[model samples]
Target: MSNILVVDDESSVLSAFQDLLGSGGHTVATARRAEAALELLKADPFDLVVMDICLLGMDGLEALRRIKEQQPTLPVIVMTGHGTMQTAIEATKLGAFDYHLKPFDPAEMLAAIDKALESTRLSRSQVVLDPETTAAVAGDAIIGRSPGMQQVYMAIGRVAATEATVLIRGESGTGKELVARAIHQHSRRAARPLLVVNCVAIPDTLLESELFGYERGAFTGATARKTGKLEHASGGTVFLDEIGDVSLGIQAKVLRVLQERCFERLGGKETVHVDVRVLAATNRDLEEAIAEGTFREDLYHRLNVVTIHVPPLRERREDIPRLVDYFLERYARELNTDKPPVAPDAHRLLQESLWPGNVRQLAHCIQRALIFTRGYPIQAGDLPLPGEVGSDRAAVSGLGDQGLGELVRRYLATYTGDRAHEAFIEQAEKLLISEALRRAGGNQTHAARLLGLSRPTLHAKIQKHKLHADTDRQAR
Candidate 1:
């Protein structure tokens, strides 16, 4: 039998939890306050912790942080009566396994306990990380060596392969969906279906039926029985994109599914049980939505068992070259052509500019440049950054509010001779090689990586261009 700790200020709650969990073939330890709970935790090894948010001495969230600091891998389930968005977000961020409202169903509580224990057991079963690759790739979706991206990769590694609910937060175009996919692809449910639901795209009228399905004759246009995305995602994952936009009513239904593991379809009397893990993403501030009463606090806590924040592209400038290389290769393959090298000035300009739309905008910008280039290296003038700044300054300087595409077309139309093209290509390649070598501090391996070239190929190019390797020591 597993040992469980239940911490609550209310004596009655502690007793009730002890009795309920004790009857289910588990040993239950009760603590009336957070301080006592911590002491008990230090004194003994418990399989799981169920603590109240509104504790007597130290609050549950603070206690949670301390507990995690001491034992990060320990699963903590927080309970609360004053369910607020701020409290839920703070608890989840502090590493709570799950959160439940005070009047939660006993069956739901037991199920949550079971799930947490099962997940914890699975996490310890074997080494999840591949020793050779964990320090390198970390995870499949993440593609950078920056400290910020490394943290993201580690988070994915820790939570994937378990049934923990995950919440990914990031600005638009930061590859949140890619992170979700990586988690699913690496999970035990990898063989099962992974369903995606864009919470903001569907109308409120149809969202419920779309997620929970609808029986025939439930509403107008409901001519046949339809299964919802959630049902179809059984034994798998449901990626809820833009989950901050989910309505309060829908949030309540989602909370029920998280709690009871079952839901009744629209106009259906029978309940359907699902073995689904939820991975939610949003660019919106859910804390503000909760304060505005638009988002439910309980639902936030449930989905945010493990939170992964994806830093925007501007925040991790060092990873830009890698991302640029990846996107350029992808688009080049699609276009059936050799990828053009980015000019040194263009690469530097890209690193210095602010990408408001994040990686997605950068990808599009690269594609647009590729389409416009006539077999020459992409120049600084080719990048279509908005706001008349940096790389885009000269392109839009005299255009007087003209669109980026228009300016790009005008710029491309100026390329007249194949001789000029060859000269431009030669000059651009030399400059790019020099810049890459400089960035790599004269390391050929690093320079090749920066330029998306093989070391041998880069060595050949260096010889062809008659460039010195000790360029990093030279003044810019």
Candidate 2:
């Protein structure tokens, strides 16, 4: 049930709304005034806000303004007994989900409530969508020197040596399919096509036809006889992505193809045999899916013959430096710019990032930095760690109780985006110098070299940033 906030001055109307929504299985909070509702809103996020147009003290219009200012994407519904068509138009302009007159249809209001909640959930995270373009999936182009990748490298080595069924598991964007392609590239079947089917992407009905092609006149819209992925991948490997999502019916057929080494076309009665290796990848737990009855147990056992789970990028912090260098060079080449390596502080923060979206998110972050930097040496402050909240919430994430000063400096220095990145680098350099000096026992010369700057330059930066005096260190 969705949590909804209802604001109205009339006790009777509020009670009636509570009775209607509570019976429909929704948790409702009734507020007498806009102040009470605003306080409640600040305490916790609500799915939908229902407000009376004529609120006491603070009108609903003002409350709506404050709500939108705080969270532009939040859905609000306006209810008024004094409803005119003009009120509805104004509410729409202010991003209201719907405007309901007093004594409106309880079912229609409830339906609107459902629509808003569903939309809000989907709008928040890009990670909810599967990402597939990480280095592991980039054929042989992705280069990494991290030790964590050694396991994946070894798996690819073992997988390449066989035509047996292989199961690759990892979180979204972990590059499971990359391992699959590496297997194909090393296999004897490298010359043949490596067919791919994203089991989660296509509709279940269409996926069956996608795997085993339908013949002309087999089903409606079967324009002509077409070979299935199994036939196309004969003498090669066929990759089935998101295998955990496959229907039980489809899983049984897949089992038959694996055991018999053949499958009949959708329209034809005759069985056609094909020599093909199967590679399956998924982010979901097939063991749990089988227990839940969504996946077939026998199919899971068959696919688990050679299971390889690729770890997420955050689990491999050692890889960030190598990935940064690789991305800088690759993107530089692609963009036809000088490949200036990232500065040390920038590299430090990048390595420290806990990439929830894994390599795909990292690649996207780097790509944005590269384009945003425009042929300049990427700085540490240029990093983006947009939080899980509103995508536009803040540039540098707070990192849960991180220093306010650090967050502020990081946010401001995020992108010279408009000015040259050199300007932001200069500001960041001063901050680093002061930090290093504070740690270096007030030794200016030592701090200068530690920061890769000349003593004279450091002295000028000290004066510019107005560093605190600690002159007694000279006598030490």
Candidate 3:
């Protein structure tokens, strides 16, 4: 459970937050004005603070500035019945974790609060680089002693304290974000917010408005002025993940930020200035994108000021055993079970296999292996690796015109329980969805397209099968 402070002039707002957060297993403290909230903050440390913009005395923006000054790491969620573009930008510029309009959905509010709290945790928790330590350490740590990893550490050390833009290049699941986080945590802007913008996850149509705030009536359905991530992350750091996937238009805007440190909001006349560091990561070959005219050459030059290449797991096979041990201990603690011993053959298989998905895939494999082992020693057969005989990949490979009939026959022959028809259908759907997600690199939109289903429908099916739990981290 976490401790939260809610500041609002209205008794109903405080009471609502009390009941809402209380039921979520959090200890709630209420205050009528910003003054009381600041006092409470000084008296005790809270995980998060929720405050209204229109307070009795000092307004939310002023209170937010004071709060940030007092505790730069503390996350504050600002809400108001009357919200404007200026107010939203000011709140974010003042270091508010999020800006929410009043009468917000409870589920959305809770989700935002959870994310803010997590962001606080990450900002506060130091990312340790201690490969020599044999014991498992809590929080995020970059555990590797390989030469390539050593170079990565050196690069982070060299550029972290500077304000130069850094481009981190690596394959998927190679801990690029972790490297970014490490840089931010060690940088001068460590006390400020670190906003992550995923280029691939957000659609191209909406990506511009997401990076640059949109003015009221900027486009259809844009009823209210919205603060963009770049403006909101002022005086801090913005980590752009999957940077190669961004469109040329968006890339030009981002280049302008890196060059001039200013941008005009969508459908707005005045240019807004911001002070923030940019760290970008990408798995795609951006040089190729530039050649193909999909990515801007000028933007690429701006982002490539200091390049840090994160070696994939396959390239640094020496780190696999250490990674395996660290994950085993970490996940064991999470599972509330003792770490199970891995057979020598199992370890050998893991080290020898080509990790196409990199570290994230290996972690998932270990997690699934642990679940399957169920307190027993892990054997080679327990690892549900791709391309194994009778595995999903093996079953689906080289399917011709008779593929559908063969798949149905396989399912029918394997399923022995009652309600076989329903079971078969569900299992088939799960496999198809999972495979599509895997092939799409956990991109739900792309996966949806591949499956010939709407994005929402694909999302519902993913939730039904709980596939996201396994893929979300990988996607990141």
Candidate 4:
């Protein structure tokens, strides 16, 4: 059993974590203040640390900063009594092993500790397994230990030692860049930079300059000779995201870069050459594009030198629980609270969903649910799932333009265009929060789940919308 330190100001929090972890067959220590935790750190070696953000003295963030300053490699899990994105982001920036929102489950926290410990162990030993090596080579994170991910890992291993340009095909939100990154990380040029360019995000007119760089005065806006991502990744890797979205012209230029390993900068006569590994990812079917003549046949063949098609989320439903567990653990750390276990019903509901948005969407959904549930053990009843609730209309109603999605646009329009119901937005959030709670039978976690709001966020909204009283069984 590894020694773990649990720190928080509240005696109840300290006692809870100690009991939770102690019961899990791990050696656990407790400290109510950051200063005490730091002293304990100096005295002995701890495999992992469980810290709180809002401490009595020096605070968690500052204490973390000091801890990192002294031991950069030590993994510190920052647990916040309150769930705040700002705090979580700051903790991540500070290199905390992970952050968790308070009121979190003990089991999830232990899982995070295990993963963080593993990351630390791996980083220290530098003896990454074949799978991890492949994941590093592919530029995508190898998230699961399942058979599908293992195959992806093996593929990366096989192709990493080679120089062939790779075409990664997968549905949206499958982490193609992660695969790209893994390739770069495992390749001979692992130390070199891995540059990325999103082919679809930029305008066609500017893509040439962006990819190939441009000489001074190449265009009206081109004031200085600039190097592009291709040149920047000269000795490293270049990732082209959304490869299928590129126009024929851009595809032709990319083809030239791949085939000849040389391209002239825009308005520059001299040809620039770079020895870079190319990794391309796209969600669309390149064969369909080839048939439609939207994508070049030769270029597709060039990139398809070592094809790696990622399976969609649905096909790998077995990995859902794993992914869900992984993400919930990560988000709980992000929320700076204790990690929460997902209810079996919620897990099944999540598995049953089509997940049309894929992994990214799933991540978003889990995050929303975690926040809503306020780091409690999540359940199907807690989810803002469309079909689960008896009243879909009631749950979706008051979402601004009749849905939560349109609220952003409505807010933007209100701010940028004619003045409108700015006041209504707050009221809508209140009504929505109330309705979500009502549908969830006044279960805080269920209510948050119904609204797809985070615990801290839902808590704040409840207070903001003044729905706390209305939704409460007893008056506050």
Please name the candidate that would achieve the greatest TM-score relative to the true structure.
3
Q: Score every model by TM-score.
A: 0.54, 0.52, 0.80, 0.54
Better model by lDDT: candidate 3 vs candidate 4: 3
Cα RMSD of all models vs. native, in order, equals 23.0, 26.6, 9.8, 18.6
Q: How well is each residue in 302-381 modelled by candidate 2, as lDDT tens digits?
A: 88889887888877787677667666766777777876668887777787766768888887888888888888878866
**Residue by residue across 80-197, what tens digits does model 4's lDDT show?**
7675646764775565755566566666677767755653443233223323223132211346666776778788899987898999888888778777777766778665556667
Candidate 1 residue lDDT tens string, 49-111: 999989777998899989987865567888888877567657755667666776877886787
Question: Which stretches of model 1 miss by more than 4 angstroms?
Answer: 1-141, 390-476
Whole-model Cα lDDT per candidate?
0.76, 0.71, 0.83, 0.72
**TM-score of decoy 1:** 0.54
User: So what's the TM-score on candidate 2?
Assistant: 0.52
RMSD from true fold, candidate 2: 26.6
